[model samples]
Target chain A: MALSTHTTTTGFLLPSIHSAPPFFTQQPNPTTQSIASEQWIRLILSYARHRRLFTLRVEDAETAGNDWDEVLRNERINRRVLPSYLSAIIASMAAKNVAAYEPPKQNRSALLYWRLPEEWAEVLHEWAISTGQLNTILTFYDITDPPIESPLTNIPLPLLRKAITILAKTNRAQLIGVADGEGVRFFAGSK
Target chain B: MHRRGVGLAAFDRQEQSKRSFAELSSALSQSQVDHLHSQLSQFRTALAHFASTHRDSIKNDPSFRHAFQQMCSSIGVDPLAGPRKGGWWAEMLGLSDWQYELGVQVVDVCVSTRERNGGLIEMSELLRLVSRLRGVMGGVITEDDVIRSIKTLQPLGAGYQVVDIGGCTMIRSVVKELDEDQTVILAVAQLNGGRIVEDQLIQQKGWTRDRARAALENMLLRDGLCWLDDQDEEFGRSYWVPSAMQWDI
Candidate 1:
């Protein structure tokens, strides 16, 4: 087989290596496995960043119709990354610090760090300043489920909290308590 | 006038002996030297004429170049001995420069793909990659040309070698040697399009499970020559040798 590159239905260009049958398997050789894992990590991060996805679970490989379907499985070759193999890949990614176990306790799933929390901090601050939401008390729910969709919209709570914490260090933000749950007030902190 | 020489003096044992043997020997040597000088000049003129007329053919035409190389060997000439070893005759053709340039490109392709193929590349794959690297203007090259270029690379002692395994030609850029069982594994993998399973080896080669596993594991773990496919459909695990695989890239 040529193992040519293919464009997915979602318009992401898959690298040619993704079409190879053995690419889905967890390699036994450390060197070979490292190369494969490096490729998978790069592919995963880029795809997650493209679709604005932030989570990857072993269950996604077990079931169908998940956001990672395009990558975790190659329907053409009848090959899919087995759950155990994907778990191994996730563990590898976590070891590399490119990803982490989501919920902070489970190993089967990961919180994809498409954008690190530090990067998200800058984006968060820039978003608040540009939208004229500065000096306003914005609740966690309001930022994640904004009326107008935003970079932060649908962002997982823990990741959003981490970004807020990073901003609080720079004195660009302050945490407060609203009537419902919790909130944060933005400050035009000196640059 | 020569009749007196045919007298008894001509048969003298020690008096004359055909006007002294030393003088006759010197006379023969002088004439032989003159004849050899004329022959050497003629050969040089013919060679110079051939070099000027067919230099481009030697450089650009593969078939013509092959024929020319054959003729050189038939005449006991080493074209690739180059100007350093041989005289300026081969240099006049500039064919060694072409050969050396092609060798560089061959090394380029081999080194670039060494990581994926584990320094063992199929001959045809190496040819295709080298051709693509040269681009359209680089002219077309045949497998013969690549083999010849590799010969030019032998002096570098980087251990570039052409190996024949089960009738397939492979270029091995790495210095490593393949053990007997690994050789069989590679040949089988080539037939199956780079995929090999332990069961197949056990059945076809009459190898025991332990022998098969040892060979496959050595290839996968020790050499990094083959990749492990744990999710194989028919078998849970299979070995895929990248060098044996036909990659269009």
Candidate 2:
């Protein structure tokens, strides 16, 4: 059992199947590394979507006690997994319009929720209709910014921008800019 | 012997660990064994890399098979004849993988050292020759376009050798030549010893048997380069000898 342990966001511990040091490291063979990185990037995006998470803070993993953060940072795997390798995958995805980057500063982490804002906007529409909030005016920040009353609250600002644009296109919502308010507001279209 | 699946890692591992014959042979010098080992290592590495990198394509390519067979022969191992039983060295070299293998379909076309015009036939010359041949007549030709007509001639036991310089190349093949009953067949048989069949003249020319036969016989006789094999009922056959007629096919 050379297996390493990983903890999922839901707090379930599981053995890591892809725990080889090379799995974490960027491949010295550029071609293989690129392919592997693509696979990893896809997997990471899907995982984030499933967990409904955005904006992963690498440094806060110790405090948050999430297993993936710790597992990803393990010295054996991280030795080859350079920031550049991850960045390349992110950039490629962005160029294809498959995913966009929320560039990380010193303490900020990336927010990659594989589903784009347009998709989220659709989900929001369905949720609003089903939950009986259509044809209502709501603060934009109220929907996206969170007290976690709804699952959509956890979505990051980048995704919020996409969602707003999508809603505006269908004449489903109007974004009204207001001065001296805590956040923006939207008026839903049609019943 | 249990045969494990062969892969790059396994091949590399075996080559790295295997002991050379020089180690066991008391009479052989160490330096000789060391040199042989180095070459073997290089060959193994190249083979492993190629096989892994081009696994799918090689499986589909006939030329790749030919090249692999040639490589196996160069390694002093007949792919058909399995290694000697219970030999550690044989096992290390992956002899089992090739054991009980069917012989590779070998087709070679030998071209003469002279017929290639001192070895400088340009692509235009090859294209012109192919264009004259029946199937490719007026057909578009490209460097990558397959020489299909030549491949078909393999069953007739025709093959080709493409010379980069000015000499002729031989194509040894297993294809059947068009019989006299079907249509007229004309082959400019070279006078040299290797039975170099020059170019195939097919289609409308293929229908003109008597003319084709007469043309071949007259050309050979006039050039004094080759003697007709008048007995064989197939296409006009001849034995060409150099220094007599210059066969321009």
Candidate 3:
């Protein structure tokens, strides 16, 4: 396949190394591999943030399989990241606390943490106060998929819960658990 | 007649100063010879004191050591002759032997690794390899020290030079000089992870087909930048720059 440059749907330009064939393969040298893995992590995190994608499956993204993710596979270059290489990259990311394995033990899927839980809490708190949603109860779904325009809209529910937990720690927000679902109420001037 | 007389007097003065040491010694009285010996001993003591004080700086700082060598040369001293051959100056500053040893090792490393990197290795990578080769036996070699050693290698016409390619300081052997076109191609290849195709060069650099082909061919055949996939018709011809190639090990 012919190699071509890839850009995200939101127009985030991928680095030129993305089109290079060797980038998809695991570099043999430790120093070169370290640099390559760093670039890969930066690319993956930025692409995930741009698409607002929280979860990534290693099989779908890295290997040649039925459910192939375009971000990890370049058809024109005929280079798909080997599963072994992808695992190495993911292991490095986990070590650096940039990502956490979903289901903890399986290590099949990863939750990409482009922003730490503390930073996400600040984002949600800012949105709540600015949108006049303070002092009112918001379900996990409401904060993640708000009806009105807000920064928290479309945020994954599990990630939203982590953020809410941070706010509860500071007494800036209170979590209310009902039979059906969980909700959080934000307090004013939690800055 | 007056000008000729003055010229003759000036020539006589020049001859007096140029007299042989043996003739001057024969002409001097016993007391004068003793006074001259004391003065010469005093000068030697002062020079030895100066050299001993600045020994560390002379060993580490290149420019300071250069000026010190110049001063030594002006006084008819050979500071680099080693402790055995060179009398006091060599014993005062014992850096010449270390510099010579390091220079030889640098040449060895460059020649041995030339086949792999085509005599072009990044400064940091070269230092790492050289340090590993030395293995705690040799003293630490800094970038400035390496440059100084490479400077010493220049007189031999070995063509060892530190070149700046794509913002990286690379050591290139003078065995093969990369012309402007080959250098440009190498710079472009560096951006693409050491792999470059004829069409990419033409498109990115706005060069005609012939110009790109000629440069690539020169680099491949003459410069030893390996050509990849020459047999594969699908990928066309891609050139791999040995220095730019990120080796796994």
Candidate 4:
């Protein structure tokens, strides 16, 4: 049978290589493994962007129904990436800086950087300016769980803090202590 | 014939006539030599003119190029030989440029897809990618054209070689040789739609399980010629030779 691209029920199009069974296995050759790693990295980051998923856990490969299911498993071929292989791919992603282990010290899970923190910083600033929230004190809750949905909605806390930290370097945002959690005040900083 | 030579003067006269005859023959052959030279130059001029006029068709038309190449071979000329090497057909046709450009593309596709296929690509897939790289302006290229372009790449010593396995043509970009077992595995994988298991090899080729495993493992670890698929429903593990596999993309 010809290996072809398949669209998942959730509307993500898996590349044709995804249909190939070897793609799920960890290749023995470093060169071949690198190819698999790159494909997985690209698929993961793109899927994360498509579904607004910010985190990938190795345990997701152990079971279905996670945000990574559409990519980590290929039911048509009766194949799913082993947790070992998924962990390797994640580690490669981490080494390449496309992802980072969230909470700083553990390696089981990572925050997927579909958009790197630098890019997220711009998005956060732009949203603050457009929504007339500039120069206002907004809690992390206000940004992550906005009244209306946002690009930042459901963004993991660690990634959000990274973006905020990046912005603070430019004086575009300042961290301020709040009653329940920390808040941030945005400024109409110069480019 | 009229009278017998009577003295030394008669003998000297006979010698003079013989020398004159030799001189006449030499003069006649010199003219023939000059005529032959002009004829050869005329042939060269005509071939050069023909090459210049139909250069585009020679580069853009596959059949025409094939026919032209056949004609060149029949006439004992190499279509690719350059002027520095003393053959003018390539120079006048400007076909070598077209050919070298194609060689570059052949390498491009082979090198770019090396990771996926382990430096061995199916011939048809190589042609597809090369034609795509050339875009519409590159015109149609045939299998002969690809083979010819590959020939031009020989001097680079990059170990690009065309190998026939399982009745399928594959280009191997790496220098490694396909051992006897690996060759058989590739042939069987081609028959299996790129999937092969130890049982399949044992049943079909009568190989022991250990032999099958060793060959597949070498392909996977030593050459990167095949990929390991651990989730095969029947065998639980299978080997896939990407060069034998048909990739639609």
Candidate 2 regions exceeding 4 Å error are: A1-17, A56-68, A75-80, A96-98, A103-109, A145-148, A178-191, B1-249
Q: What TM-score would every model get versus the actual structure?
A: 0.71, 0.36, 0.49, 0.77
The two-chain DockQ for each candidate, comma-separated, is 0.40, 0.00, 0.01, 0.49
Candidate 3 chain B has its poorest 10 consecutive residues by lDDT at: B225-234
Model 4 TM-score on chain A: 0.97
Under CAPRI classification, how is model 1 graded? Answer: acceptable
Model 2 per-residue lDDT at B66: 66
Q: Which is better, 1 or 4, measured by DockQ?
A: 4
Give Cα-based local distance difference scores for all models: 0.85, 0.45, 0.72, 0.86
Residue A116 CA error for candidate 1 (Å)? Answer: 1.8
- Candidate 1 C-alpha lDDT tens digits along B1-249: 345556675668446654578789999999999999988788767866886798887666767877987987898866666443335554576446567777999899889877667889888788778888877333378778888888767756889999998788999999998999999999999899889999999999999999999999999989999988877889888999889887766
lDDT assessment of candidate 2: 0.45
Runs of candidate 4 with Cα error greater than 4 angstroms are B1-97, B134-139
A1-191 in candidate 1: lDDT tens per residue?
56678899998989877877888877777888888899899999999998999999999989999899999989898899889889998999899888889788889888988899899989999989988999999999989998999899999988888889999999999989999999999888986
Point to the candidate with the largest DockQ.
Answer: 4
lDDT of 2 by residue, A1-191 (tens): 13345655565443342343334534333444444556566656666666666755444333434524533444433322345555555555655565655663342356665776767887777666656666665666767764556767766766776787787787776666545442333445653
Tens-place lDDT per residue, model 2, B116-145, is 122222334344444444235544554333
A best-first ranking of the candidates according to their DockQ comes to 4, 1, 3, 2
